[model samples]
Target chain A: MGVDERRQQLIGVALELFSRRSPDEVSIDEIASAAGISRPLVYHYFPGKISLYEAALQRASDDLASRFVEPPEGPLGARLLRVMRRFFDFVDDHGPGFAALMRGGPAVGSSTTNALVDGVRQAAYLQMLSHLKIEDPPARLELVIRSWISLVESTALIWLDGRRIPRAELEVQLVHDFAALAAVSAAYDQEMAEVLRQGLKDEPGEGPFSDLVVRLVALASPPAV
Target chain B: MGVDERRQQLIGVALELFSRRSPDEVSIDEIASAAGISRPLVYHYFPGKISLYEAALQRASDDLASRFVEPPEGPLGARLLRVMRRFFDFVDDHGPGFAALMRGGPAVGSSTTNALVDGVRQAAYLQMLSHLKIEDPPARLELVIRSWISLVESTALIWLDGRRIPRAELEVQLVHDFAALAAVSAAYDQEMAEVLRQGLKDEPGEGPFSDLVVRLVALASPPAV
Candidate 1:
């Protein structure tokens, strides 16, 4: 393999190892053996274990960030649901790795790892804004968006614990969560209200947001006798 | 000072120092000077910097957990607002320390520190259930409560950055966020819906939940041409 191909292959092997166990627990010799290369060759591509680990993380980060990328098509709720599904797919595929990276494993204070994590968040935020098609979101809109992002993150992290809630339900619920968060903000700010109005304009009756409204109305009605 | 009192004083000094700077940056000498004691005395009370940091974190964790404690009286929104106020107060008082602890500082993988943080979350969760008067929460309701708690945590962490938005608004918004989270779940789960119904029974027109409902209604109205 070419140098670039060889480097990518090493990162792939390292990420697979890191996914099953924390980065610190994985050894250099193990990576070399797994990659079907010598330990010195592993060092030839990267300076040290930390460097190799970071390369793996960078690739993982890029893969995770790409999960948030959805075309600005269809209803906003449907779009968000798709994004949530993909996000969880990544979490599901890379459970331990995702948790370790999120929980700050041994690479805890490493600025590079931290930046990669934050980059994913920033990318997700910007992607959401693009979905909203809002050039300059109001402060309240930003808060709502950022808060929803954090909710999605914590939800995924917790979901990984026992796989307690069905992944499908959480995906739909998360989309509803976005609407719920924005609706609350819309109530307070006209800009947000306008944003919500635009967002719901194209939503169908079967969309997550519509389902949420139906559920809420059912809840508001007097209990069955 | 007596041994226990001296230990308390040292923890206080260390927490104060850690609040301003990362625990790793705050040396034993600084802690000793801050406590008006010698390095040996600091060591005498605690074996090492890590132990002392854990003690300080334990204290902070307890303090944080206590902020979630509120009487199970009056409107739930009012109770939650009070809780949010106290929570932000703690965040304001210990900005860097809270961020470091949450973001995973040098003490990242320390099981003791991780337990303390999780303990605080569990305590807050139980406190919320007590406030709701729910002995057994359905899985959906559990998700709502846990998700809200995570929302509150991330909100505070983000707010601490520049505190760009007014603190007072965020506090009130958080209470609304809780109602919104529960309201969304209530739409789907009868158990959660009943919980919301009970929560809203005594809420006044001026309460956060009521305010959220009013805002949502206003947004739902046909926009003026």
Candidate 2:
């Protein structure tokens, strides 16, 4: 293989291992042996274990960010469900690595790792904004959107830790959490109210978003005046 | 100081340090000096750094659990607000240690630290259950309550990570989260609906819970039939 191809191959092998366990738990010798390459070659491709780990982590972040990019051609609810399905799928496949990344401190929380992770968040946030068809949202809208992202991360971490709820239920709950948060935000901010109204109108009337909106509208009074 | 008092004092001193940095970052000698004691004396009370760290962790855990213990004398909303306020206070006071504990599974993932952490959750859960006056809740209610706990924990973790939202706003949002989750559960489960109705009745109509209930009922279709 060409040098580039060789580097890609090594990173692929290391990503699989990282997904299975933390970088600290894996070793250069083990990675090289798993790749059918010599230890010196592993070092040749990557200067050290830390560099290799960074490459592997960046690869995972890229994969996860790509997963969050929803198709821009459906009802908002359907698009969200599709996006969530992809997210949950990633969680299922990379449960250990995903947990380690999200928990993120003293474990996988180096400045370099945190920046890579934040890049993923920024990507996901932009994707959600595009899906919602909202650009240049108000501060409250922005906060609500970011909080939903945070909520999803937390929910995913906890869900991975314990499969107390089924996959479908988890998906429904997470989607609802976004809508519910938007609804709550709308109650507090007029701009958010309009954004939520538009987002819901973009969704099918009978799906989870509508149902959640219906319930939240029932709980909260008329949109913030 | 007497032996028991000395142990408590040493643990308190260690907790202050732990609150400033991760347990792994704090050393036995530093802890001893910080405590105004000799290294051997520090070992005389606790076997080693891990033991001292564990003791500090347990102390913080116990303090958190105790904070969750509201008077249970007011409306559920008031009680919840009080408990949440205390929770945020703990986070503020022990930001580093709290972050370390919440970002579990590597740094604080040892069985002992986990058990102590789990004990805090159990205590908080029991405290909420006792306040709600529920002896044996159904699976659905139990799940709702436990998920709220998880949400609070995640919110705390994220809040510490970024103080984007004001402390009062964060507290209010968390309190509303518990109410919102419970409201959603009540809409689906008749048993939960009754529990919510009864719980809301205990709060003053002018308070937040009553207002939340009033708005939810308006959206949800009349006290869930």
Candidate 3:
């Protein structure tokens, strides 16, 4: 097999082992044995155990990122919903692998992994923010995005664990939930902006508090609404 | 120190170490040294590294569970809001430790940690069910609880990470977001019930599709107004 093919095969085997056991439990020997190759062959492709685990994690993270990175053109809400649906579907199908990644995959400690996951999360959030027509400051946008992703990951895991509701139904429920959360976030942002504007005038140099108020005010003002 | 005091001390030290580094990287010897005890003494308190890690995790989990296991006292929505606020507060204060546990603390596999996390999640859901004046089947209630927990956990983590919103303001946002999620879930559940009622007249078999429809219908029904 070519280098790329061999590398891919190693990752597939690593994933299989990761799925069957904890990341820390799986040994390099086990991965090699499972892949029907010698330990040296496995080492040839990856530098170490951490690298192998990260490679497997990156593969799953990349798959998920690719699914929603450039969402197809459509209504913002609909497009966001599609991305969520795809995410939930991926989680359901690749239960163990996806769970490992979201639950802080070994790659989590690696800046590369953080960037990959954060990039995907930011893209989805941007889509939602654009749809809402709210131009929040970067920090506020970060809060909204992080909050939304946490909700998605938590909800998806619950559904994946077979909580009596089927995946399809849960997906619909999540879309609605996401919409509601977005609306609440928008309204709260607006309310905070008003409060900040009123409170800041009385205290000009409140340091971080003033900075926070400014961000809220900027976020609260809707775009051309 | 008394048994309880020593135990708590161990948990604290374990959390500190776990948060700073991966479980595998930290040894019992390190935990012992950090706690100002010998390795053998550490072993006396807990069987091994894994046991110590699990105990630490259980401590954190127990702390959160104690506040939430039983539904808070008040009106349904008010009680839920209170519990959720406390939940967020807990996450905000104990984020690093909570993150460590959720990300699989030493000795605990992701699946095992996930199951523990899900247990706390389910408990919160039960609390919500008890507080809400819903008259749905237990199964349907389960779905709502699951969805609500998912929403709260996701949103809370964002706030926990020191987002632009002040912690106090983030708590208020969560209250609004959760109230909105509960409202939507109730409405969606009601709509599903209506669909089920309409479809039951046309289909009478107990096949997979019929079972799925029945389950969805039950899950979708809203709490009694």
- Give the range of the ten consecutive residues with the poorest summed lDDT in model 3 chain A: A195-204
Off by over 4 Å in 1: A22-25, A107-109, B107-109
What TM-score does chain A of each model score against the native chain A? 0.96, 0.91, 0.67
What lDDT would candidate 3 get against the real structure? 0.60
Per-candidate TM vs. native?
A: 0.92, 0.76, 0.65
Worst 10 residues of 1 chain B by lDDT: B102-111
The model with the greatest DockQ is 1
Model 1 chain A worst lDDT run, 10 consecutive residues: A102-111
Q: Choose 1 or 2, whichever is better by lDDT.
A: 1
User: Which of the two candidates, 2 or 3, achieves a greater DockQ against the reference?
Assistant: 3
In model 1, pairs of residues that clash are: A215-B187
Off by over 4 Å in 2: A17-54, A71-75, A100-115, A129-143, A161-164, A189-195, A214-225, B17-54, B71-74, B96-118, B129-143, B157-166, B185-204, B215-225
Q: How far is candidate 1 from the true structure (C-alpha RMSD, Å)?
A: 2.3
Better of 1 and 3 by lDDT: 1
Query: What tier of docking accuracy does candidate 3 attain?
Result: incorrect
| Candidates sorted on DockQ, descending | 1, 3, 2
Q: Per-residue lDDT tens digits of candidate 3, residues A1-225?
A: 999999999999887777555576789999999889999988899998888887787777667766665443444445555676788767766676555556653433445555566766776676555544456645555565566576677677666565566666656556656544544444445553432233223333433323332432343243364
